[model samples]
Target chain A: MIDWIESVLHITVQMGTLYLLASLGEIYAERSGILNLGLEGMMIMGAALSFIFTLAYGHFAAIIISIAAGILMSLVLAVMAIHMRLNQVVAGLAITMLGLGLSGFLAFPDIRKNILLSLNPALPEQALMTQEAPKLPEISIPLLSNIPIIGRAFFHHNVLVYVSYIAALVMWFILFKTRIGLSLRSVGEDPATADSLGVNVFLVRYLATVISGGFAGLAGAYLFIGFHPFWQEGMTAGKGFIALALVILSTWNPLRAVLGAYLFGGIDTVQYRLQLFGLGAQSPYFLAMLPYLITIITLILISFENLRKRIGVPKSLGIPYSREQD
Target chain B: MSRKINTPFGVIRIERRAAYPRHIAVLTTLLAVLLAFLAVAIILVLIGIDFTAAFTLIVESFTKPELMLNSVKQAIPICLSALGLGIAFKMNFWNIGAEGQIYVGMIASTGVVLLHAYYGLFDEHVLLPLMFLTSFALGGLWCLLPAFLKAKMNVNEILTTLMLNYVAILLVDYLIHGPWRDPGGYGFPLSIKFPDYAKLLFLFGDTAYTGLLMAILGAAAAYLIMDHSKLGFEIKVVGQNLNVARYSGIDVSKVIMFGAFIAGGLAGIGGLSIVSGIIGRLRPRASPGYGYTAIIVAALAGLNPWLIVLASIFFGGLLTAGDVLQASMNIPKTVIQMMQAIIFLFILMGEVFKRYRIVFEGKSGGDMP
Candidate 1:
């Protein structure tokens, strides 16, 4: 019983950490009035790039290169929507299609092989079964980890989990408290007015997209290196879209986004637990779809007028700004 | 960039502007699409495939009569769905749930097929129409939710429709894998092969010529509706300007709902044709993402039904060519998708050029005319 409890907790922490990082990045982009529907493709691209790079180089270098690639791709979106003044939604969709096709083309041949053997040549044959995932070093504070339930949940986690929490807090602080945050909000709210105030609306939007891309890349890296430690085709599996929905459900608040991600994570974790507890064979697929069902429900609920008025979205979200038009 | 004069009422006046040459845009889009194909060709050449032989294989695949018939057989669903979407786009209603509606229609048609096979209530003649009606009803019903949400609640229909695609996909996957799995099939995740009573008749010997005929008929019907009906006028008015439509007492919501219903119903019929004519058994990945591809077809054809037929045939030929390239040239099937994306991007860019003109003026001079 104790071992089962420990394993469930471990799974929850891993899933929650991955989702929290990705949703936080989505929060930043949506708050800036840009809906990056290409998140799924971006995450997949990041995962593939990180996986290949980590196999060739080490962990740190792979993470850096993946982040750079993600930012570079996001720049294309920024150019089409901001400079060319194309429709944001369609442009985002086009980018997603391009990313998916490119990644599939690149990863098709190598995906069929056992990638782990190329990465770690020193492991024994039996170790392959047990070490399906490479263990990340956990950081347990000497005194804090010994407390009660809260201590085990919060203090005893890997470096990536800790970084996700810190990153969420930093995002909340920067979005709510800083001058740049104010400018970003203003640009999202009314780019014409923001530009009239000499706020450089285009530049702010470009920077926000690039930063969001970097965070999303890190999210993908976490999926590869921390959660499963394996690569699969089309593996990001709609998590990026869920993150986009979570941004709306959280009312574009980064802090609320963290809470929302963990809540979804908990639901997903419980569904898996239910399956493990001798449910029928088909239960897992249904269980896996729970988070997506909740997201759709949440979207419908938020579309209610009173609810939306209470937690307002940015007024001018997804509308491309044209300087000449104003 | 040019001017023409016309005498409509015996008065010749200089028409300072004419519509941008659509043929040029189409040619440019085709050129861009071919350039993307050429890039794949270069890639194949570098990978040690004989590029010329591969190109010949693709070209020959399109020229054969049987292959051309097969291409049209496949293009039917895409053309039907694109026709429906073209109507909705004309009214500025972005109904992206044609995919889900297609699945719903398939589910409905399959239900009818099972009923007829088990109960023996209707002859084959009656059964076919009943199956088509059932599919159309289910497809329209599936679309109604997103349409209702958009018209009544101002929800973004794009996201809602998109989300519904996954739900429909999962629902179909669940059914086929569980309750609907054919007992006699030895555990394969599929339904029973639909009986002859449920199948669509062939127009010629051993070909899905009836399906092709239905697609052509659908295109004609859509053309008549958009060009010669009062409802079409209302749709056009609403698309051009909503306030103007409202001011004219056109009931914009009703128009939108009507367009959506018909569009969705047509797509549902398309799905029915696929199962009844081509595949014969329900499977999880029944569509090779044809519903989404219809979006490109609709846009490429400029929302005209006749042009949509042409565009669908063109795209369907491309799909066949891509398959040939995959087998003969060692090229990935994703190259076709990449080319489609490139074409869509260039078309969108062409639209920008159509709507706005770029002017350059000297720093110290007045604006150039």
Candidate 2:
């Protein structure tokens, strides 16, 4: 029983880290008053890019490339939502559509069919179809590895997993303790006020969105290399959207983003675990529904005005700011 | 938010226009489309593709009668879904789970068909209407839960509706994989083929025309209700400004619920048409993301029902062209999604520029510099 429990906990942490990385990024973007809904799109691009890059370069370089792809995707969101002052929802949705479509199209069956005007598949495109993903390296702390259950469950994880934790801590400090953090929060809560106080609202928003996009990209790379070690089209599979909910659940707090991600991860893990219980008799589809069901229930609970206020949701979040009018 | 900024060379002032000329709006939209094609052309050239060849491939694909029929047929459910989406979008209700609503509609219609077969129930003529109504009601029921939560608890409908989409999809998946699975189909995750009685009536061309007709009817109804009815005015008022709508003594929650319910109902009809008119079976994955695509169509059409039909058909052609491109150019049809996204991004950018004209002013004499 303990062994079974330990395995689930370990898997839970892995999944939790995936969502944590994404949500932590979202927390920053939302803090800067930009609701980027393209996390899934960006993450998928990261995954697809990492898969191709990993085939060509080593794992670390692939991760970097993936992060760059993520940053690039987020820039699109920033340009639309901040610079152009377009509808964030529409722009974000378009980014997602573009990312998913671009990745999928890039890896289609060798297009060079026997015909008069057959388009040859690019080398990377061909490789995407026939490449085996190399697993990300795992690292176990020296003394911590000897701590038995807790160590095995938490201490021992991949480099990316540890990076997620470190990222969360760094993000938490930046968001809570630092001057830049304050500026970001102020920008999100009241951009007009923030702008009046000489905070470059536009710059802060752009930085926040780009940084968050970087984090989401790392999460995608982690999922592909550390967690699953494989890539599929749309493998980000609404995790981006789930991360969006996690930001609200955590009230835009980076540390809380980690906790909220784990809670969601627990729901996902337990659902999968449930399918194994009762001697493996339960339907996995029913199990799959549990996370979504819990998400709805959680959304309902948090939106009750009481919890929402307690969590300190940014007042100006998701609303475009016009400095001149204010 | 509106803003004006001073640059080094000139002061570029951005001011919102109360309204622009209709011709300019049309002209700008056309220009944007043309720009997108130009961008595509540049991409094609960079990728070593001849534009002439690609154009011929597209035109040739359209000439094929089967492809044209398929494109129109495919456009039907998407148009229906888009019309439904337009109503909710106008009301500021983000019904992201039209995908799930579509599933519920399919499930509801499929259930009726299965039950009819099991109990030796209604005749074809009698059952067809029943299927339509059942699917509509069930779809509305599915959507109502989220709207109810949104109204009562101020719940974020985007997240709730999105989450529900997965639940609805899984429910259908579970049903199809379990009890609903056709025993005679060698364990394929699919329900039995829908009976002919449960099928829709054809108005013209293929029976798929029923779906197109339904979409047209829904769009017309939405146009009338939005432009000519009190409910439409209420929804518009609520959408435009919640405070003003409340001041006008409107039940904001009630208005939200009505629009939302209808949105789901229309999407459900789209789902019903897919099963009854297109697929003819409750398969594991019935929709090819038509519900999601409908959102794009609605936005592209600027929420106009008449324009939605044209946009839907245009998208349908694009989708068909994607396939043709895949066959000829060896590119995946999924590239169309990227093209559509680029077009939408341009649309949003165009909308921003349209709403606010940019004017350059010479730098002031005593500039800080």
Displacement of the residue A14 alpha carbon in candidate 1, Å: 2.4
Those runs of model 2 whose alpha carbons end farther than 4 Å from true positions after fitting are A109-129, A270-282, B1-12, B360-369
**Reference-based lDDT, residue A288, model 1:** 65
TM-score of chain B of each: 0.88, 0.92
Per-residue lDDT value at A190 in model 1:
86
- Candidate 2 per-residue lDDT, tens place, B200-289, comes to 656753655666677788889889988999989998898889999999899999988998888898888888988988888889778878
User: All models, DockQ values?
Assistant: 0.33, 0.57
Give the candidate number with the greatest DockQ.
Answer: 2
lDDT at position A162, candidate 2:
85
Error of 2 at A282 (Å): 5.6
Across B1-369, the per-residue lDDT of candidate 1 in tens digits comes to: 322223332322222124677666677667666776677677655545577886776677679877777777778888888999999889888877788878877888887887776677677778879988988887777777777777777777777777776777777777788878888889998888888767876566443578768878989999889889999999999999999999989988788888888888888887887788778878886877778778888878888898889888877777787787677655666666666766666666666555544432224232223
Number of the top lDDT candidate: 2
